[model samples]
Target: MFIPYCISLYIIKGNKSIYDPAFRLFALNMGFADLEFMALVGIFPAVSYFLPFPVSFNVCKVFGAFSADAWFTCIMLSQMMSLNRFVGIFWPGNAKAIYTKRNTTITLAFCWIQGLIWTSFYLKPNVGLYFDSKNRGLIYDFRLNGTETVFSLNMIFNYVHASSLCLTYGLIYLKIRQDITEPYRLTIFHHFIPVHDKKDVSYEDNILEYKEIMAAPDLNTGWRRKHMLDPKLANDRKKENKVLIQACVICLLHVAAVATWAVSQKIATAKYVLFIPSIVGLFSSGSTGYLYILVNSTVRQKFASMVSKCWCHKANQLSNYEARKKDSGIQSISPKKDNEYSELMEMDDYENVTKN
Candidate 1:
C-alpha cells in the first residue's frame, strides 16, 4: 500500500502524461494486492502466533484463502504489466489507442473479480479442511487436504505466468538488440557505398536536409530526437537493457525459489526451508517496482521532489511552531504593559512580512 501510494503520488505530482495509463493503474493495483496479501498471510499469522489469543482454525483458513487469492491476482497483474510493455515497444504506433485509461481500469477490475471468485470457492466454508493421515498436527488441515488441488491450480497459473513473462522478456530483448544493431548496420552500409567521382552538390544538400529534418522534434518531443540520434538512442536502450536483464534474472530466481518451495512442501520438509525460498520470491516481485523507477526519469525526479517537499514542509511546520512558542513565552515573561505587547505584535508582523 505504501509503495503504491508513493508511486502513484509521485506520478500525479510529476504531471507526466506520457506513460501508458494501463501500466500505471496496474502498478497501483499490484501495490494494493501485495499489501493485502502480506497483511493476510504474514502479519496476521505472526501476530496470532506470538499473542496468546484463542485463534480459530477457521480464521487461519480464511487468511490463507485471501492470501492465496491476492497473490494470484498480483502475479496476473505482473503479467499484464509485461504485456503492457510488450505492446509499448513492439506496437508503439498503436500504444496510445490500445492502452487507454478506461481499458486499464476495466482490466484491473476484472483481475480482482476473478481472484475473488477463485478464493471464495476455495474458502473453508465452501470446502472442508482436510487432515493428513500421518503427522496430522504438523500442517494445517486446509493445506494438507487441498495440497494437490491447490498445487494443480497453481501449476497451471505458474506455467502461464512464467511463460508469458519469458516471452515478453525475450521479445523486448530482441527488439532492443535489433534497434542497437541497426545503426551499426547502417554505418557499415554507408561505408560500403561506392564514392562517385562526380561532384554531386545536390546529394550533399539532400543529406544535410535529411539530418536537419531528423533533428527536429516530433509529437513526442525529445523522445523522437533521441530516437534519431544513435548515441542517445543507445543510452536509452542501455537503460532498458539493464532493466530487462535484471527482470529476467529475478524471474529466473523466482522460478527456482518457487520450485524449491513446492518440492519442500511436497516432501513434508521443514517449513523454514520452504520459507527461505518464499521470502526470496516475495522480494523478487519488488523488482517490478524498481524497474518502473529506473525506466522513467519523470518518476525518479518526482520521487526525489516528493521526498524533498515532505521534508521541507515538515521543517517549516516545526520552525513555525517553535517560533510561535518562543513568542508566547517572551510575551508571557514581559511586563503586562499594553505598549510592550503592541510593540511585540508589531515586531512579529514585521518579521512575518519580511519572511514572506
Candidate 2:
C-alpha cells in the first residue's frame, strides 16, 4: 500500500502537464494524509503489539493524536474532492475561476488547520485518544469513563462528510443525465454540461489538461499541452467523466469503512469483532493509491512507465556488473598465461643453446 501510494504520488507530481493544479493539490494532500494515517494509526500500533515490551499509554496517545489529525484531514480532503468534481461538471464555465491555485491552496490550509484543532480536543488528559493493542482499536478515554461525547462528535463529522458527498454526487448524476439523452445511460458523455453557444464551452478554461495528447509522444520523454477545438476530440470531457467515476468509487469505499467503524464502536463488545473495523479502515486507506492507478488511465500509464524504466535500469546495471566481472577474470588469466609462455620460450632457447 505504501509503495503503491508513493508511486501514485510520484507519477502525479512528476507529470504536472498531465494533471490540473487544483486536482494535483488535492491529490498530494490526500496521499500524504493517508500515508501518515496508515503509518501512525495502522502500522505503528500493529507493530507495537508484537514488541517485547509493552507500549506506554502516552506513546499510544501521541501516535493516535497524529493519526486522528491525518484521518480528519483525509476526510475533509475527500469531501473537498467531491465538491471539486461537482463544480467541474455542473459549472464548467465558472470552475476555472473558482478553483484557481490560490483558492485551492487556501482551502487545503484550512482543512489542515481544522484537523489540528479537532485533534487538540482529544489530546486533553481527561479526554484522550490512543491505540489499544489489547483491544485492537483506537480507544477514546473520556472523563467519568463516558466515551459517548467523543463518539457523537466523530459520528457527526462522518455524517456530514458522507451526506455532502452523496448530495454532490447526486447532483452530478442528475446533470449528466439531463445532458445525455441517449438510451444507454452508461455511455461516455461527449459534453458534461450544456452551453447555449458552443463557443461558451471553453474546455481549456475549466480543468487542467486531463487527457494525453493522442498525437503527441508518450509521457516517458515529456509532453506539451494541447487543446482540442472539436467537442468529440476534446479529451477534457472524457477525462472529466473518468474523474467523476474515480471520485465516486473512492467515496463509496471510504463510506463503507467509516460505517464499519461506527457500527463496531456502538455494538461490538468482543475483541475479535473490534479488530474487523481496524482492518477495514486500513484497507480503505491503503486502497486509495491503487484506486487512482486503476481509475485514471493517465496515472496507470505513468505508473507502468515508471516501473518499466526502473526495471530496465536495474537490468542494465546487472549486465554491466557481470560484464566487468568477466573482463577482470579474463585479464587476470591472461597475465598468468603470458608468464607461462615466456618461461616456455626461455626453456626452448636454453635447450637450443645446449644442443649447439
The sequence of per-residue lDDT tens digits that candidate 2 reaches over residues 95-176 is 8899998899899999899889877867766667788777788866544343567668988998888788878888888787
Please state the error at residue 262 of candidate 1 in Å: 1.9
List the candidates' TM-scores in order.
Answer: 0.65, 0.73
Q: How many clashing pairs in candidate 1?
A: 0
Error of 1 at 170 (Å): 1.2
lDDT (10s digit) by residue, model 1, range 1-356: 23744574456434535243666577668767866765664556557656665567676667666766776787778777777778877887898888887888788888898888768756745353221223211123333565557556766777777777888889898887786656643453343233445566466664654455445534232222223334444444544565566567656755664565456555554435545544555565545555555555555555655566677687774343346667676554433333344346545644553344
- Residue 72 CA displacement from its true place in model 2, Å: 0.9
* Residue 29 CA displacement from its true place in model 2, Å: 0.6
- The candidate scoring highest on TM-score is 2
For model 1 the local lDDT of residue 98 reads: 88
Candidate 1, poorest ten consecutive residues by summed lDDT: 129-138
